[model samples]
Target chain A: DVKVTQSSRYLVKRTGEKVFLECVQDMDHENMFWYRQDPGLGLRLIYFSYDVKMKEKGDIPEGYSVSREKKERFSLILESASTNQTSMYLCASSTPGETQYFGPGTRLLVL
Target chain B: AQRVTQPEKLLSVFKGAPVELKCNYSYSGSPELFWYVQYSRQRLQLLLRHISRESIKGFTADLNKGETSFHLKKPFAQEEDSAMYYCALSGLGGATNKLIFGTGTLLAVQP
Candidate 1:
């Protein structure tokens, strides 16, 4: 079975703090994605990486960055956490032209 | 431009009733469609995809190119079926296989 795991289920960060959300997938997939899910807005892509050290900005990459140093892990970074950045963050992995498997998600709260 | 739209924000229904979650897309070329579900306190997962042409957990979605729609349908609804449903689109002529997702619909199955 495919398994995607996130570092945290819930997190609290103060404004202006730097936060990192990590995702790891057991399957050896080539594609990894980071998305922020908000109520009524669904899942908005922030970044995606098809291979190690390669990244592409998604629809909403204004407040976030991503890293894929290893094939099995992807990380989303918030340089400066803001109240508006608080949302459920999701990670997914997939092969080329195939379906994506998602992580458990990180519910972040910025105060 | 590639985009996915889910008109309904929430759909509340009693158990045993039929369910249909609408999804539409705007893309110049052929697109791949999928339905993803996230149950309460659980990780998001793929429910079904248009290319698969298979039913999952009693849910199925048919892609209609004429209307640019891929709506999810179930003959009978159950309380366990209540969750957040997201419609996603891909195959935007990119090798990365990045997906564009809809805002999502909350299915509330009340007994």
Candidate 2:
């Protein structure tokens, strides 16, 4: 079975603070993605990296950025945390257009 | 624009009842659809895909291009089947192969 792990399961940050959410997949998938899951909005893609150092903005990339320095790890960075940024963050990894495996999400709370 | 829509926000059913979760998509080209499930305290995982035409955990979804629907169904609902279900669409025109997800439906199977 594939294992996708997130650095944190729960996080709390003050408004205006910079926050980082990390994800690592052991399956060596080529594509990694970051998304925020909100009630009634579902999962909106923030950023996705197809390969190391390559990234693309998704539907809701505003206020969020991502980094992929290695094959197994993808990181999401929030330049400034806002109350509206409080949502469940999910990380997923896939091989090209194949099935995606997801990490146990991180629930972020900005106060 | 590529999009996935899950009409129901919550569906409550009794054990041994039939289950159906509706999902529709809007995409120009051929769409690859999938059903994802997230159980309590568990990572999101793939339940089934339209192309494979296989059922997992007694759930099956058939892609109807005419209606642009891929609704998940099961003959009998088990308590363990309760979870959040998300419909995702891939197979876009570009090589990036990103997925668009629906808002998700929460299934509650009461004993």
Candidate 3:
């Protein structure tokens, strides 16, 4: 079984703070993604990495960035957290042309 | 551009009753559709994919290219089957394997 683990299940940050959400996958997948799940809006992609040090912006990449220094780990970074940035963040990893395995989401609340 | 739409926000049914969750997509190219399920307090996982044409946990979905829909169905709803269902689409060759997800439908199975 594939395992994807997130760094935090819940996090609260003050406005203008920097926040980091980490994800790790055990299956050695080549693609990693970061998304924010919001009510009624679905899961919107924030950023994705196809290989180490290679990143692409998704539909909703503004205010967020990602890092993939290694194959097994992907990290999402918020340059300056704002209240509107609060949402359930999910990390997923997959091999090309395959099903993606998701990590337990991190619910980030910006106050 | 690819987009997935799951119209229903919530659906309720008796334990023994049939259930259907509708999903539609807008993509210019041939689409690869998928159904994902997330049980309470659990991470999201792939329930089924269109290419495989197989059912998981008694759930099946058929891709209708003309209608641009992929609706999930089950003959009988089990209490354990209650979960959040999300429909997703991947572009040709998986296009870097990025998936666009719809707003999920929360299914409640009543006993």
Candidate 4:
């Protein structure tokens, strides 16, 4: 079975701190994504990487950045965490234009 | 721009009653639609896709190009079927096929 794993299931961080959320996919998929899910806002794409060292900004990319050093690993970085950034972060991996396999999700709370 | 919408935030039904979860999409190009379900404390997983044309666990969905909708329906609601359902869309063209998700509907199956 394909597995997309996130580094943390739950995290708490202070405002103004830099935070890192890691995601690793064992399926050898070529695409990885980061999204923040809010109560009524749905899931907003923050960043996506199609290949190693390649990244693209999604609709809501402010205050967030991403790095894909390896095809199996993708990382989401919060340059400066803020209280408003508290939300559930999900990582997903997929082959180009195919069904995505999602991680368990990381619930991050920025205080 | 591609977007998915699930207007109902919550849907409740008796165990033996039929259930329907509405989903709509806005996209100019041909898009692949999908229904994903997340059981309590479980990771979000694919339930059905328009392309498959196969029903899973008694749930079925048909793509309505005229209405731009892909509503999920089940003949009978089961207590185990209670879950968070998300509607997602992916563009078919050369554009990167990142799945855009809906706000989600929480289904409550009353036993």
Query: All models, DockQ values?
Result: 0.75, 0.71, 0.78, 0.68
Quick one: ranking by DockQ, best first?
3, 1, 2, 4
Q: Ten consecutive residues with minimal summed lDDT in candidate 2 chain A?
A: A93-102
Tell me the tens digit of each residue's lDDT in model 3 across B1-111. Answer: 578988899999999999999999999988899999989899889999999999899999999998999999999999999999999998867648889899999999999
Ranking by lDDT: 3, 1, 2, 4
Q: Candidate 2: where are CA atoms >4 Å away?
A: B92-95
Q: List the residue pairs that clash in candidate 1.
A: none
- Scoring model 1 with DockQ, what do you get? 0.75
- In candidate 1, which residue ranges exceed 4 Å CA deviation? B92-94
lDDT of 1 at A17: 99
The residue-by-residue lDDT of candidate 1 on A1-111, one tens digit each, is: 999999999999999999999999989999999999998898999999999999999999998988889999999999999999989999999988888899988999999
Q: Score candidate 1 by TM-score against the native.
A: 0.96
The residue-level lDDT of candidate 4 at B110 comes to: 98
lDDT of each: 0.93, 0.92, 0.93, 0.92
The sequence of per-residue lDDT tens digits that candidate 4 reaches over residues B28-101 is 88899989998889988999889989999999999999999999999999999999999999887444678889
User: Which CAPRI tier for candidate 3?
Assistant: medium
Per-residue CA lDDT of model 3 for A1-111, tens digit only, reads: 999999999999999999999999999899999989898888899999999999999999989988899999999999999999999999999998888999999999999
Give the runs in model 3 whose Cα sits over 4 Å from its true position: none
How far does residue B4 in candidate 4 sit from its true spot (Å)? 1.6
Model 3: iRMSD?
A: 1.3
For residues B1-111, could you state the per-residue lDDT of candidate 2 as single tens digits?
A: 888999999999999999999999999888889899999988889999887889798899988988999999999999999899999998844466688999999999999
Candidates 2 and 3 compared by TM-score, better number: 3
The residue-level lDDT of candidate 3 at A33 comes to 93
